[model samples]
Target: MKWSEISIHTTNEAVEPISNILHEAGASGVVIEDPEELSKEREQVFGEIYQLNPDDYPEEGVIVKAYLPVTSFLGETVDEIKEAINSLVTFNIDIGHNKVTISEVNEEEWATAWKKYYHPVKISEKFTIVPTWETYEKVSSDELIIELDPGMAFGTGTHPTTVMCIQALERTVKAGESVIDVGTGSGVLSIAAALLGAKDVRAFDLDEVAVNSAKLNIELNKVHDVVEVSQNNLLNDVKGTVDVIVANILSEIILLFVEDAFNLVKPGGYFITSGIIQPKKQEVKSALLEAGFEIFETLTMEDWVSFIAKRP
Candidate 1:
């Protein structure tokens, strides 16, 4: 079978939203080729470091690749994807070059080729994200390993936005506490909260695909017992307050539910928000404050920003 590869040359800031656009367009998965991967510093304490090929990456910005089966409506799907990505500019997100191109390839080539890009990486002090395909051995007694496949939806949980949220979970999630992970994606954050000893974890995503993908990863991590996966629009049907509420979605979406988050967090509990670009950090912070959350800690990686706000 043949598949069309849609490649977009864009900035790192746009990777999350663009990948989401492609996923919504029926792409099963995405391949990110960022030049920074060639020079990234990895801590060898968790496990082996997989070597990256420089040729696969763009010299500037990032390349997001997704495969769509060859079909008669392929052209229209591609056009819609391009439009969706371009629309991100209205949210104050920089789209960079935004050069999009398409090429045809054999299914055999991409079916398992994208797996090579994922490996065990220690994203935070206590959490290391290991792909389900890889075998890893923990080097410390207190290390937490999260196994994920990211099958057909979400990411490998190594994106800076995700890493920051996991780190925040480590700092805030206490044993027996309850957690609500908004826009759970592949359910990585919910799993982390469970592993960190949260007794009850709830994961919600509007996309049914993401809900299923997260359910698989949650079970893979053996946290299904503690985490409940469901399909819901951000806090719309949510009831009861949780000890910690973490969201790693676009900042614009985060802004929409600030008051909901505030109302759903127990006193002195935390609200962790990521997937925020530098330009919109102040805007989100302002919203959180307006919702009555006290700014706790702000985490920054590359050009992304994450905020840990506490309800006083």
Candidate 2:
């Protein structure tokens, strides 16, 4: 079989929405190459890495590449994808170069190429996010494994923000507790909560496609019974207080409905929020505080941040 590799050149601010577009187009496993990574410095004591080639990345902006099966309607699909991307202009997103390129590759090579980017990663002490194809053994007797495959709304849930959410779940989710996961892209946090022993987990997303994708993932992780996936705009219309409220969404979205979040959380309950860039840390913290939340813990990984707060 043959595959079409679609690569889009866009700005960092547009990466999330464009990646979501590719997933909605049936393209699987996006690879993002940002020019910023090539020059960033890292500690060598904790990391041993090989040299990166400069030619593979765009000099500016970002490149989001994905693989789709070649079909007779391939051109039409590409056209639809382009149209959808252009639609982002209505949202006032700066698309940068917005140059798109397509190439053909055999299935064998495409599979091998993307697999090289994924591996079993222990994102937290108790939870490890493992690719569906990778075999991983639990080093600890109580270690939890989350089997994820790329090609959904997001990649195999190892992004720093997602990682911190899972780690926060490990520390805050009490057995038999109830949790509401807002903007549950790929349902990673909801699944983590269920796996951590949440009795009833409500996973909500505004996008219908994201809601369905998260439902499939919830089932994939065998937490369908405990985690219920629904299409919702933030926490509006949700009833009954929960023990924990987890959301791995944009910082701006978190700020918009934080008051609703506070109202839905019971006294002494916890709220875990992520998908926050470094610069927005103080702003989100101030919002939570204004909503009468006691800031409990703030976790940072790389350039992202996550926060856990307690409802007074």
Question: Cα lDDT of all candidates, in order?
Answer: 0.90, 0.84
**Candidate 2 lDDT tens digits, 86-110:** 9877755678899999999897878
Clashes of each: 0, 0
Q: Highest lDDT: which candidate?
A: 1
Model 1 quality (TM-score): 0.95
Highest-scoring model, TM-score: 1
RMSD of each: 1.6, 3.3
Q: Any runs in candidate 2 off by more than 4 Å, and if so which? A: 11-14, 34-61, 69-98, 107-112
Measured against the true structure, the TM-scores of the candidates, in listed sequence, are 0.95, 0.83
Candidate 1, 1-312: lDDT as tens digits: 789989999999999999889888988778899998788776665334666778888889999998898999999999999999999999888899999999998978868868878888888888888887888998689999999875547587888899889989988999999999999988899999999999999999999988888888887888889999999999997999899999999999999999999999999999999999998989999999999999999998888999999999
